[model samples]
Target: MTTTGKIVIVGGGVTGLTTGVALLEAGLPVHLVAAEIPGPTSVAAGAMWGPYLVEPWAKVRRWSLVSLDVFRGLSDAPATGVRMVSGIEAARNAVSAPEWNTLLLGFRECSPGELPTGFEGGYRFTVPLIDMPVYLQYLLRRFREAGGTMQRQFVGSLDEIDDGSVIVNCAGLGAGELAADDSVRPIRGQHVVVKNPGITEFFSEDTGLSPDLVCIYPHGETVVLGGTAIDGEASLQEDRVAARAIVERCAAVEPRLAKAPVVASRVGARPTRSEVRVEADSRSDGAPVLHNYGHGGSGVTLSWGCAQEIVQLVTATG
Candidate 1:
């Protein structure tokens, strides 16, 4: 538990911050460097617990289950901006319960009336819905309290972070350049935030297999409507066309959304890979490194577990 060495975490989104905080709390000196920490992407996440579109389903399920419990506990802390909300995932076709459903709270098959029209089958469950901006602030606060420090610096390469500790690469899309990972591409996502319209629960149509994206997540006084997933598109430019489509599609699920006044619109490019890279690497000089990025759309879902894994990996050799 002593300060074995200084750990440098690259990237400032959920993954980087979570890993940095975990390592710092484990009594290791940690520092974070990033071009945009808590940048557009992490803040623009739909920020749900579902393991949507993440590969290597086994590992993702394990990580997601761990994060679910952690976020559930954090829900009690007002500043964490996490809450256990019950919601129904309506599927256009019949689908069996996902294996990971058992790990969640209040799992149930929805009755016909419980389902929104056009969804032939669905399930209801309670999962952690995070208000990302608040949660990130809470994470930064906790990390500072744990003696972690951050620098707003850009890292052109891992060698630039050689400060006597293994570098943990949570650099997200930058991995395409930072780690020279060509497999890492961006899945651009957009969201529409509107007045809550008194919606208390959440609703999402499982469009994972389909191209259409439709979801309504109500957090307090606002509902986060989402989204689009266009692969290889890294543009952060807001698309008014996409925004209107998101609202129109979301309104189909919840009628009130049709008249809700639009509050804001945002965009983010999810760093995606066929499988998330969470393993050890080495430099030409054999300097140890840990790669943990390319989470696609499930960074929030897998943050805690992956962060904990980073801690274990560091401790095993520290």
Candidate 2:
């Protein structure tokens, strides 16, 4: 199952692009094929550096920490669209600190006065807040600069690709059909973008298993307010009602947002599974295939770590 052929990566979202960059930097020949580059799901993310609604806690924690380290280094370069921002993540109900709190900078328990009106418990920390649109482009440029090639084509099946090259599937939601894995499903997320009202920090309400989420991530001039997480919803169309609710919820947390004018709206269907799948498989023809998808809402948070693991798998199998 090993030969001297270039690595063929499927899907051009953050997962695929980041994987390509890692492989190319590792000095492997790589080519990417996807239906869309800077995938809508990745771009639409209100991408803060925190593991949300992801599973297999032990591995997720390790992967998230690895990504956090990379993002911290990237924060120094503004062109990468990664910024170290201070913020509060509080919940309406009393809660204990998360085990990963120690991994963040400036980790502290929020004083009662610092907690927003309804939040009964929370924490203060500094983490990378990625502006996805800019960050995705950065990844693409880095990928190309590393001598990686890209082809804009939809992959209907893994068998269709018979180039004799090892395949890495990062098809996100599309993996459901491609891998015939029924566990993968869509968790639709919507967010509202508004002109920043001089806000420099981020704020998020810890919405435990609830479908409705409240988070505000500001990217300089524009702030992304999110959102709703409806399981089994795959539509990418913007929901005006959801947009308005997002703005209202964010405004309730930060009064200045009440007057902020609407800049745009975004909708993305997060590819979710009971647990993230990052394993190796072989096609009927014996070509090795690596699966790297189902990061759920933490695609950006887990990208680098997952990619690094994929590179390891490639190295190990060879």
Query: Using TM-score as the measure, which candidate wins?
Result: 2
lDDT of 2 by residue, 133-165 (tens): 999999999999999999999999999887737
Give lDDT: candidate 2, residue 102: 72
User: How does candidate 2 score on lDDT?
Assistant: 0.91
TM-score of each: 0.96, 0.97
Model 1 residue 161 CA deviation (Å) reads: 2.2
Q: 1-318, model 1: which lDDT tens digit per residue?
A: 213778888899999999998898888898888988776799998878888778798788888878988998999988899998889888888988877787876799999999888889999988899989889999999989999888998889888866856788998889767778898999899999999999988898877655458888888989999989988799999999999999999998899999999999878999999998888887777888889998999999999999988888888744
Regions of candidate 1 where Cα sits further than 4 Å from its true position: 1-3
Clashes of 1: 0
- Positional deviation of residue 257's Cα in model 2 after best superposition, in angstroms: 0.7
Stretches of candidate 2 exceeding 4 Å from the true structure: 1-3
